[model samples]
Target: MRLALAQLSIESAAVDDNVERAVSAIETAAEEGADCVALPEIFNVGYFAFESYERAAEPLGGETHRRIREAAIEHDVSVLAGTIVEDLAASADAGEAVPAESGLANTAVLFDADGKRRLVYRKHHLFGYDSAEAELLVPGDQLPTADLGGHTVGVTTCYDLRFPELYRRLVDDGATMVLVPSAWPYPRVEHWKLLPRARAVEDLLYVGAVNGSATFEDASLVGRSTVYDPWGTPLASSDDDATVVYADCDPDRVDEVREEFPALRDRR
Candidate 1:
């Protein structure tokens, strides 16, 4: 499958403009013959703009995703439309799982080539270090996966990269590839580079990570969207600029690597 990672620039708190930007990126990826396009976390609202999270929070089928879904159908390409700041109460009223307390969710939704909703992945882990995400948002309880691009794809958000157990759970659930939509900041570039590749190498699966492309005031996003093979080799990567990165990944490669190495079988 040909994967296109959209490294987009987020204008702080500019939801509509960012959605338009994301659509342009999707169109570019489809024109390039990409099988799927993944956007960055909080692409519509800047991750550092914590104050806007509540105000910008929308329901699951809100306008942001509606626009993206339309693009997915028009372009005939699968889209992992990054993530949206979701209102948990709206989801609860919609009959989905509601948090114990009233709050928001960092939710990622997948749209198929036909513009159908495939999966709704709420970020399992919320960022807390030097940030208010943990206090402001509720962590996800469910782990959702999608069947797409000839692989079982699982979605995880930014800080979830630090936790391998989550990825291991995904592997156990027959995930052949994992796509991460992140809003990673600067000064932790080394950690950002190492973790995703490590997850792929250890699990013997493809790891596709897409991050935001610009730095915000006081906090900055380091754009290095990358794709890793099952063998942990870098297939494609972008620098700290807003651009698109693509990689051709074979779903069978994970099975090939796992059968050759059989390391996952030795786990205690």
Candidate 2:
């Protein structure tokens, strides 16, 4: 299937503008004959918009998700509406104090071709160094996967790239491909490039990293969205610009690589 990685610039706390940009990208991707498109992490409310979290956060079926669904239907293609800041106020359990304003969550939602909600994956590993994500957000419990056009796809967010165990579990659960939506900043471009390829090689699956092109504080995003095949070869990549990277991935290649190499068979 042909996948489009939408690497657009995000304005911190500019919800309407970001959503409009994402919708436009979806239309463009569809016109290019893409079967599915994935956006960058926290595309709505920029990743470092901590103070705006409470104001910008939305519920699962709120406006943000509704806009994404409408875009999917209009474009007639599946969409991985990248991570959003979730408001868990109403769902808070007893004695939880409602988290004062509501805790944030790096949540990714998937919509099928017919605009049905296919899956939702919250970010498992929250980044804390130089960011307030660890203090402001709640970690996800479920490792969600979905079937997208004959491909068993797994979903993960930016910071989760460093954790190989999570990808291993997804591979064990029959995921042939993984989609990572990221808002990775500058100065750590090496980590952003290497980690996803490493995961793809180690897991023997296709890996797609969709990143944003935005500046936060003094940090600018490294908009090198990339796709890696099972052999750890880059099939498609983008430079530091607002563009869509496309790749044609075959699920059978995963089986072929694993069968020929038998690396996974020797796992302890």
Candidate 3:
């Protein structure tokens, strides 16, 4: 299937403008015959916009997600609506320690071609190094995967890319491809480039990483959206610009590589 990665800039706290840009990218991708389009992480509200979490956080099916659904339906293409801040619901009956003021989650929502919500993934590994994510968000417990146009797909967000165990588990769960939506900043461009390729090679699966183009106070995002095939070869990549990177990935290639190499069988 042909996948389009939309690497666009986000105006911090500018939800409407961001949504418009994302929708436009989706339409353009669909016009180019892409079966599925993926956006960068936190495209709705900029990543690291700590103060806007309370104001920008929305329910699972709220306005931000609704806009993404509309765009997917209009374009007749499946969409991975990057990441958004979710208002965590309470376990009222259990009497558990439900967070007051509503907990926050870094979430990614998937809309199928017919505009049906297919899957949702909350970021498992939260970044803590002098960042707001460590202090502000609640980590997710479940590792979610879905079927997208004959491909077994797993979803993850920024920071999760640093953890190979997560990708290994997804591959074990029959994920032939993984989609990572990120807001990776500058100065760590080497990590951004190497990690995804390493994951693809180690897991024997396809890896697609979409990153934002926005600049923050401390650092600017390195917009090098990239796709790696099962053999760890770069299928396509983008420069530091707001652009859509495309790649045609064959799901069967994963099986072929694993069968030929049998490297996964050596895992203890």
Candidate 4:
């Protein structure tokens, strides 16, 4: 399998424009022969645009999703359309029984090449350190995984990267590759770089992190969208920019690496 991480440059509150950018990025990735393409967290409204969360929030089957569904079909590539501000109220009003309280969630949506919605993962870990994420969003109770491009792919949002337990649970649930849709900002580049690599090395799964690239009010997203192999090797990476990073992946490489290292058997 081949993956393309769309490191988008997100501007605050530019919903329509950002969506167009995402579509363009997806098309580009498809042209590059990527089997799957993943976008960043809160990309439409921008992560720093806190005021727009409630207003910009969409239901599970909203226009944003429709556009993405179309894009996925048009490109013939699976898509991880992630970290959309999901309005729980809208879903509840639409007569669907949401498991969480009436609020919002930082959500990820996955679509196959046939334009079917495969997975919906609300971010389990919300960032509280100098951010309003924990206060603004409801934590998810479930971890979802999907089969795509010869890999069992699991989903997570930006802040979930700091939690290793989430990844471990995903692997236990049959995920050979984990997709992290992040809107990580500047000044924490080291943490951003090492955490996914560490998780990949420890868990014996491919870790793909896609981050936003643009600067927003009070915080600027430093784009270093990276993909790590099971042994913590950087397959593909990019500097701080709005571009697509591509990497060829082997779904069984995790087993190959783990079998050679034999470190997971030592786990207590």
Looking at model 3, report the run of 10 residues with the lowest lDDT sum: 90-99
Highest lDDT, which number? 1
Q: Write the per-residue lDDT of candidate 2 for residues 75-160, one digit (tens) a residue.
A: 89999999898777743532322323456677889999899988878898999998888988888888978988778999999989
Q: For residues 1-268, could you state the per-residue lDDT of candidate 4 as single tens digits?
A: 9999999988899999999999999999999999899999988889888889999999887989889889999999999996799998898888755657489988889999999988988888889898998889898888989988888999988778788888888877988899999988889999899898998888898999999988876888879999999888999999998999999999888778878997777877
| Candidate 4 clashes between residue pairs 3 or more apart in a chain or in different chains | none
* Per-residue lDDT of candidate 3, residues 1-268 (tens digit): 8999999878888999999999999999999999999999889989968889878887777888888899899989999999998876632233423333358888888899899988878899999886888798888777878998889999988899888999988988999999999999888999999999999999999999999988876668999999999889999999988999999999888889999988899988
lDDT of each: 0.91, 0.89, 0.88, 0.89
Alpha carbon lDDT at 184, candidate 4: 87
lDDT of 3 at 22: 95
lDDT of 1 at 203: 92
Residue pairs whose backbone atoms clash in candidate 3: none
State every prediction's TM-score relative to the real structure. 0.97, 0.95, 0.95, 0.97
Tell me the lDDT of candidate 4: 0.89
Candidate RMSDs in order: 1.1, 2.8, 2.7, 1.1
Q: Which stretches of candidate 1 lie over 4 Å from their true place?
A: none
Error of model 3, residue 65, in angstroms: 0.8
Task: Go through the candidates in order and give the clash count of each.
Answer: 0, 0, 0, 0
- Which pairs, if any, clash in model 1? none
Candidate 3 Cα deviation (angstroms), residue 223: 0.8
